[model samples]
Target: MQELPGVGLVERARAVAPLIAREADEIERSRRLTPSVVAVLIENGLYRALLPQSLGGAEAPIETFMQMLEEIAKADASTAWCLGQCSVCAMIAAWLDPDTAQEIFNVAPGILAWGAIAHEARSVEGGYRVTARWDFASGSRQASWLGAHVRIVEADGTPRKNADGSPEVRTILFPVASATLHDVWQAIGLAGTGTDSYEVADLFIPERFTAFRDVPAALREPGPLYRIGTGATFSLGFAAVSLGVARATLDAAIALARAKHPSLAGTAMRDNQAVQGLIGRTEGDLRAAGAYLYATAHTMWRDLCATGEFSAAHRSAVRLAATWTIHQSAKVVDAAYHMAGATAVFRSQPFERRFRDMHAIAQQIQARDTHYEDVGKAILAGG
Candidate 1:
């Protein structure tokens, strides 16, 4: 399928937007993306967008990948959320042993996904015996491999510490089949993400399959993308997804306003000065937020390319921009949903689903108001 591609990654993503949109109902019903939709994503190279070139991935620029995510998200937030999870997990390949990384990511149909929770792993001969039930394992149904972040401990239950006195934590890798998945993703938003819980019982993860996530010194791929760190990449990708969801909801509202007429209004909603003003103002807000996010991301990337290092200031700026973008995006979605009136209350329409999804994105830690405090602290410290 990769060989038949005439258009680039971004073009392919744009072309599949309709298919993704068409699958939203099925995705919502199944609590996971269907096989057909997953096929479209894999065929389009969306899952491999963030992987390094050395590992048979596109190694596309971060901005390009973010745009692709935004495009997918505009069609379906769940699919975009799952794609973001897989793509971000793939970034770990840049830090894994070259041979191990290649074998894991170069499968016939590439797959990678992981949960964010840290489990417990006991240090043992040649590896660690890990045990934990991880929640929010997005894309697990479609993933070939899964990971668990674990804190290393002695067999006697004492925590292992590095020379600097920091608790030793490592991300352990295993096949999806090795873990048990529990159907717990009963959320109002992103219901199709299949973000269920997975458990592994005393599984032995060889040292080679585990690595420190977001550690720049251990990276095997020297691209500037990895240098920006995993956390920042997540902030950027999810922010893009939030923005995309916002744009789609706003567009749906505009379409409804232009066509639907209220009982009291003689003209269509578009003719209503209040509705006109809402659309105009919301459009400006989304655009400005998007611009801020993209500009901040580009600046960070450029700094990485120029100096081979992303300073503390760059990281702080990314956090700030992503948090601001997500909050603003939620506002835009709220405005659009409210303006859509009774039409938005129906489950069949696009506005309702996007309204739930945008709020869910806002509730995530990346969008927390405390992120503003973190950035403020960084600035005060002269980052």
Candidate 2:
């Protein structure tokens, strides 16, 4: 009921921060957002921020959407992760048939979750039949639709190939009920993301419900947001989540340092020169990383809007900024956790959960240090 109409989506996300913060404990314990929080997210239009406007969605700019994720993440990382998963799935609408896309996203929840599958889909008369178990299906608990990325094959089990002589891969969509959900999301961090593994056997997927998982030229929408492509959008948005979690952890640590006295030290942590220096330097580092992330995202978004295409430099810059931001955020969280001392290790303290969550984020593929090599290669190629 606390809807703030006429405000930007980022501001709207900020408005829900208190509620998300209040539910953080329950979310972690239950391994999913509560129904009430889900309803609030739906009512606030948070899930539709990345959807095409033609389908009753916001069609928000990439920067705005990433900022919104940051605001939500400051309250709870799991919630922010789920929001990112669902919203980015909506972006796939740009490649879907209008009728099918509308039908899938127009549902009440309109959330889609999926995972990687090693299985191959055997082509049939009208569609393909897939039997595979996908892992890391984040946000699956509340999704309306589910997807599986499969390699296409012929009836005799030979892999299908595109005109360019590459193996054809397609992401086939199916109703959430068609897949059997497994309650194996037990994780030390981001437990509330509900990133469970799912199974689908002999599930029939019509051709219209599938598309090339990474082909940008096939997108149906002409908006710049879609033009940026899913890889860049996910990297930037997830990096913002890392930054937000780091921001919250640093704030919490500062609060504890100012109030509690260390047993070994005669004075409070805030009075200790070492603690002071650590927090000060870490804050500066976080701010610098955040500035780079946002600046790169804004530049890419702007360039795509004006030119309808992104240069190799722009793509490499986005990936480099994201990888750097994630690593820096993890460092900030580690410093904050150490500064909090014994208090940080307790579940009663925010640093404990954030420390675990930040590490998990760093382990994601997008946050890997190898991305630096990709950026370096791009620079060399360009030069």
Candidate 3:
């Protein structure tokens, strides 16, 4: 292990604890991170942790990213969601040309926001004319730019052929100035994430600023961080969201339960067997989910750094593991709400908000159906 320098990540998060918690409700109400909260994140330099050191970032170990994610999520899941996407994208920036990366990190290390995950882009003159509507662009309300996806298209609209005569697909980074951020994220939970959609009409993107290739995790790029797997980024980021929500829900429930008494009897809430059972089960579930996620994340990172790549089978396994971890975390959070009785359901308490947010997170593509199918196929082929 390399010796890290300067203040620790844990310390950085501690410095912002009051800030993230202070505006969490406002974030939930407005469906976006508050300016104060963003400032705290920037000042702490959390986003800089993922970018390569050469680009004026810490390029900290992947383990640090995973653990820090859990801590941030615990404070505010929506803010963490916005934080997750930005920081995870920083890893991609680390892999980019130093010049192109400077255009992003040099201005402000942890303040850039992006949404170019899915391969929805194509090539054009000088660069690529991207034409696709990216969905669930988390934190879009405050985004300065977007890393969107595009598929190659002929001027007549038919898909174009690549060098091998196959359909060409690429991720075109469309600046926020050229795209429209649609406020479609209204929901019962995770409203603060500002997970809106964006549309681009004949947006021209230059090639120098884009990364058009297979998934980063699938790439054999000489850099160790780039070879983990194409989809692990989604898994890690979403799993961190789950851990955060579960932690928040559990904390809320405990606080309320400790203060209240069981309604039908003279017993205190904490003294009731039923309440104890709920707490026990919820805590166990949360611990298991956190443990599994951290373990798998560390393994993936270590393997990548040492081997420069991991097998496709191992990568798929990690994704499956991470997805299941999210599901488990949700179950634990729901149980926490049950332990808190009707009090947890009231809008006044954080429990209801966290519950809604967690359920919403579970429905994300990273946490839902598609991955189940992917894992099933990988299993049948022999894991």
* Per-model TM-score on C-alpha atoms: 0.96, 0.96, 0.90
Error of 1 at 261 (Å): 1.4
**lDDT (Cα) of model 2:** 0.88
Candidate 1 global lDDT: 0.88
Instruction: Give all candidates' CA lDDT scores.
Output: 0.88, 0.88, 0.72
Q: Which stretches of candidate 2 lie over 4 Å from their true place?
A: 1-7
Give the clashing pairs for model 1: none
Candidate 3 per-residue C-alpha lDDT over 1-383 given as tens digits, one digit per residue, 9 for 90 to 100: 75372237767875686689889889988889998887778777776666666666666665676667778888888887887777666666644566776776676433445554454344456876665676777766655667665566765667877678877665555457788778898787888988888888767777776664345532323555546533576577678778877888888888877888766778888777888788887888888888887888787777777776666765776788788988998898888887777787687777888888889888877887788898899789876
Residues 31-118 of candidate 2: C-alpha lDDT, one tens digit per residue: 9998878988999999998888878788887778889999999999999999988888788888898999988999777888887556
> What residue pairs clash in candidate 3, if any at all?
116-147, 120-149, 120-150, 121-149, 121-150, 121-151, 124-128, 217-229
- The true-versus-predicted C-alpha distance at residue 244 of model 3, in Å, is 2.0
Instruction: Provide the global lDDT of candidate 3 against the true structure.
Output: 0.72
Q: Tell me the tens digit of each residue's lDDT in model 1 across 1-383.
A: 56322237778889999998898999999989988899999887889888887777887778888898899999999999999989999989998988988777888466888888576899888888987898878889899899988899998989999789989888888988898889999998999999888999979888899998887877888888888877888899999999999999999999898889998878888899989998999999999999999999998888888999988888889999999999999999999999988889999887889999998889887898999888888778877
Q: Model 3, clash count? A: 8
